[model samples]
Target: MAVGELSEKRPTRYEIEDVEAADRRSRWRFRILFAVVWLGLIIGLAVGLALTGRIDPAFILEVGPFILDGTPTTLLICFSSILLACVLATLGALGRLSGNPVLNAIASFYVSLLRGTPLVVQILFWYLALPQFGVVLDALPAGIGALAFNYGAYMTEIFRAGVEAVPRGQQEAARALGMRESEVMRRIVFPQALRIVTPAIGNEFIAMIKDSALVYLLGVREVLWRADVMGTRFFRSTETLLIAAVVYWILTIVLSFFQERLERRMARGDR
Candidate 1:
């Protein structure tokens, strides 16, 4: 009698494994789809530029001088203005935190006024109004002052947040050690606050760099304006603008690398 032998098979892990693998493949496909879409868009834009006669060599060369020089000029304006803004912001934050009501009110009002006004208006105001007081500043200085004023108001919140981030017990600990409020703040609070606020400050730096472009509207000849001038004069507007965009992208990337490193370093200290 040929009895039917029981066919023994191990239970398959195939279904579960297949589902997981399929999910991974689907995720990869989604990512690839997104990347391809963006890539196509960028290529389309580049092609459009070429078709529009924007990539012409004569156009690129026409404003090369302005394009090159405008980079360093923009950097100078941004760096100097940001430095000044940080200084003023620190002081304003201190004033706001101070016990004196008058100082607090003045600091608050300064922040309110600057934050309330449009940055372009501030730039124009500094450029146009200051001359009425017989204190005409060069384009560079006027531009810096306008940027600093606008950013300083914004930075007050950053500084204040930093100061407030320090544990209250830190101040009390300093006081327990017989230190005065000023000394405690200088020695303990500000240092901690700086570290805490460094990332926020880096963000402000990026914003300031972009905002520096507005200085060109005041005829300071920064990168964007230089590109505009070159493009208009030679009708190679696309090439010049592309070059400017590349320059700004490079700068932003470089700065971002440092920011990331600093953040990692700060986080390490936290651990």
Candidate 2:
């Protein structure tokens, strides 16, 4: 192109630049507006609190423990229970896939029993009814066991899906290479299946964490129970609940972040 033609093209560059600038401005405008509205509301509240001499940002610190107790207890129960549940789920999946009718029936019944009853009922049954039969567990153990059994039933399906997703050709290839069926599964299929369902299984883990709070009904001293006790005793229902809400939000967010990273690593193995 001649110099004169190039000069004309430089003006088109400004047109493209203007479009890009406008796009960025549009994107940030609403974001800034959202921040402004929220900021104004918070500032207004703080000002009102100062005028009334009721402002104490540090006040929440005292109430935070009542909320954090349930979170830690909930986390511990969920982690332990979900760990056992995963193991049970793996066995159940294998049993369901087995050729033996006895094994299959046992696995099927386990799933049915857990799923058929309400989780709350099962918790009560384990905590209360078991005592009548001389099989009583402390509140924590009973709650954990109930959580595991219930989650195991759901995870059975996840594990089974993972197992079944393994391509038939991969199995045949393993067999043709003189690998035993069990070896083939252990070395090949299980790993892939695990990767395939990692995301779903992580979800189950987080769900287990939340459900652990239901154990409060059993009078366990977890976070929510602590929140209730503190709220009642201190007459700070709103503050106590806000603390618990923050705990749950933080826990879920931290867990989900790692789960996402784990999924990404698993996906990388595909390449």
Candidate 3:
């Protein structure tokens, strides 16, 4: 091959850096444009609602703080529930993958039952129906339990897949080193499995944040519950509900941004 032709094909280090810089610049430009457009649309909607007398600026100012006060509770529920779900999912995955028929059957039944029932019903069951059987739970605990149980069942499959995705050779090598099965899983398999399913866990967490609003039905005083109370009191349901919706939307966007950053960091290991 000619030297000039080889040089043209391979590209110099400086040339490669220049191309990467240009690409990054282009991406940033598009991102800024998209943000501007999104803001414009939101502003346009607010103006239209105001002109139509569907929303009141003064009412929003008064009620916004009250609704926002519930943000901490909402976040508490989400974080607490996700932590519990992670534990349950890990155990459930093990049960599902166990060689013992009893363990497998229990895990299968748990997953099947939870996945079959609606989340709303499960929430109610914990908060309401359980009381009749003398197993009463407080509102916060009920909410957390329901959310954790429901999400754990779904996440079981994700965890199982992550565990199974670990190379068989690695487990064999661990066994050859005389590690017990439990030790091998704990030291070698589970860590890699957790990393593999992290993105899925992030997504489930985002969904759980939104689903946490359902706890309002149990009167947990979350964002939606607070908004509902204030809206009913003032007879400005539209304004209160819209503000709550915006809060949830903002939370979702913020969480999604962090999730993307986490995913990028995790992807670096692959490279």
Candidate 4:
């Protein structure tokens, strides 16, 4: 190749630097635009509420503390439900992947039924229908049970996907080392699967925290229930509901931050 042609073909250092700088500026512009869009939406919501005369500053001031006090109860139910869900998801995932036909069928049916039905209906059934079958449960327990079963069914797929993502060669190598199937799963497969699934589980946990408000249908006295009571008492349903929505949004953002950190830590571990 001619010397002049070779120089033309390879970009000069200044050209490469200019291209990289332009790319960085474009990315930063997109980031700023994204942030502004979200901020605008939030401000628009507030303006709409005010223009509609649906919110009262005095009511917010008076009732906000009372409603905020229910955060602990909401968190309690969310964490409790997630704990149960994790256990159920693990077992359901194992059953679905098991060699035994009955186990597989049971797991399949459980996931289908729970995932197919509305979570609200499930909550009502646990709260009301079970008594006829002599499995009466208190409101909190029934709500937690409904949440656990519903989330467990959904998360079962996450667990299964995580487990399946683990390399088959690793399992075969474990077997070659004389480890039984169960032992291999316990010591090798599950730990790795856990790392893969943890971020997904965190996302589900955040979703469940929002869904936990549905437990209000069971009179579980969580944040939504408190908001309802405050709205009804003060005749400011819109305000209270909006406040509840804001609280939930804030909580979800905070949880998401922690989830991101958890994901980063797990990624570091993988490295």
Candidate 5:
């Protein structure tokens, strides 16, 4: 082949850079276009609802802050429940993994019983039925307890899987160093298991935020309950509920963004 012809066939460094830049520009354009389309759809829906008298802008403006006032309580419930769930889930995972028959059975039954039942029933049981057994709890505590217990059962498998993901060789190495089983688990196993499960824990935390709305049914006055009260009192149920829905949607989006970032950071080692 002629040297001139070979040079023409192969792109220069500047040409390759130009092509890469164009690809990035194309991707950014598509992202912006999609964002615009989504915004247009949401705006059109809001306008349509307003035209049909299905939503009230004035009512939303008046009541939005009132409903948002309950956000702290909602966050409190979610955070507290998740913390408690972490403790229970850790213990439950250990129990599930233990060779002892009694601990294994207790953990197995707990997971089965909680996971098999509706969360609403559990909430009601804690708040209402427990009173019959002289174990009465106020609405807030009852709601938190129910959420923690229910999520703990579900999270147990996540924790157990995380623990199992830790290589057996690592544990053996620790044992060779004269470490006891408990010390090995505490010093070598749990930390790595925690890193593996952090993403799943983040997902559960986001889910728990939404599930915290269920606590409103117990009259703990979270966002949904506050919305319901204002909606009923003002006869603008649609508007009030829409506001609450927006709040939850925003919360989910924000949390998901952080979760993505955390996952990316955690995955840097793999890259």
Candidate 6:
């Protein structure tokens, strides 16, 4: 073939660019299509339930306020429990990583037992069983203590992983500067670990919010408990429960949005 003919047959630079851009657009379209399908499915399910008479519009209207009224109590328990969990998690993480065998054993035992048992059992133990031992607790305190203990066990691993993820050299450098082990951890290690684990911690917090629903078993008037009360009162248990579900979903979505933003900000700071 002649050189001129060969050159003419080759794809132009603009043609190649156009093909690449088309590929990128197609990929975006595929992603958008997937999202649309999920959104459509969710909408369809809601419409189906409404049409099938499984969900009561009238009851929803009547009970919505009652359910919402309990959101503050739910939030209070969630935040308070997570606060206590954070403290326990910090102590547990430190103990787990410590050289002291006694601390290590104690931390390990706590984590093992808490993680092994069902959360409901722990809640009952705190509220019901503990009273036999002269450790009677009011409903709120019992619920909060159970939540904190359960989540602390789980979060201990997250904290430990975050702390361990820090490079050994950082600790070594701090120690070389005449810092004691405690100072090195406090001044250098824990802060960085916190950044590493903040997203995971946020996720745990969100999960805890939902798990807090179980506090209803203790007769705490959180969202689910209030929903049950309204449901029983009006004989519209299904509708009330659905409303509570929606409220919890909304809360989680809002929290997740902030969690993502915080994660991105932390990532940027790392860079």
* Candidate 1 residue pairs in backbone clash: none
> Any idea what lDDT model 1 has?
0.88
Error of 3 at 126 (Å): 0.6
Off by over 4 Å in 2: 1-59
The best candidate by lDDT is 3
lDDT of each: 0.88, 0.84, 0.94, 0.92, 0.93, 0.93
Which parts of model 3 are misplaced by more than 4 Å?
1-25
Which 10 successive residues of model 4 have the least lDDT summed?
A: 11-20
Q: How do these models rank on TM-score, best leading?
A: 5, 3, 6, 4, 1, 2
The TM-score of predicted model 4 comes to 0.88
Q: What are the per-residue Cα lDDT tens digits for candidate 5 across 54-156?
A: 7767778999999999999989999999999999999999999999999999999999999999999999999999999999899999999999999999999
Which of 1 and 5 is ahead in TM-score? 5
- The best candidate by TM-score is 5
| Candidate 3 backbone clash number | 0
After superposition, the stretches of candidate 4 with alpha carbons farther than 4 Å from their true spots are: 1-23
lDDT of 3 by residue, 180-244 (tens): 99999999999999899999999999999899999999999999999999999999999999999
| RMSD to the hidden true structure, all candidates | 7.2, 5.1, 3.5, 3.6, 3.4, 4.5
TM-score of each model, paired residue for residue: 0.82, 0.79, 0.89, 0.88, 0.91, 0.89
Q: Model 5, residue 261: displacement in angstroms?
A: 1.5
Report model 3's TM-score to 2 decimal places.
0.89
Worst 10 residues of 2 by lDDT: 49-58
Q: Count the backbone clashes (under 3 Å) in each candidate.
A: 0, 4, 0, 0, 0, 0
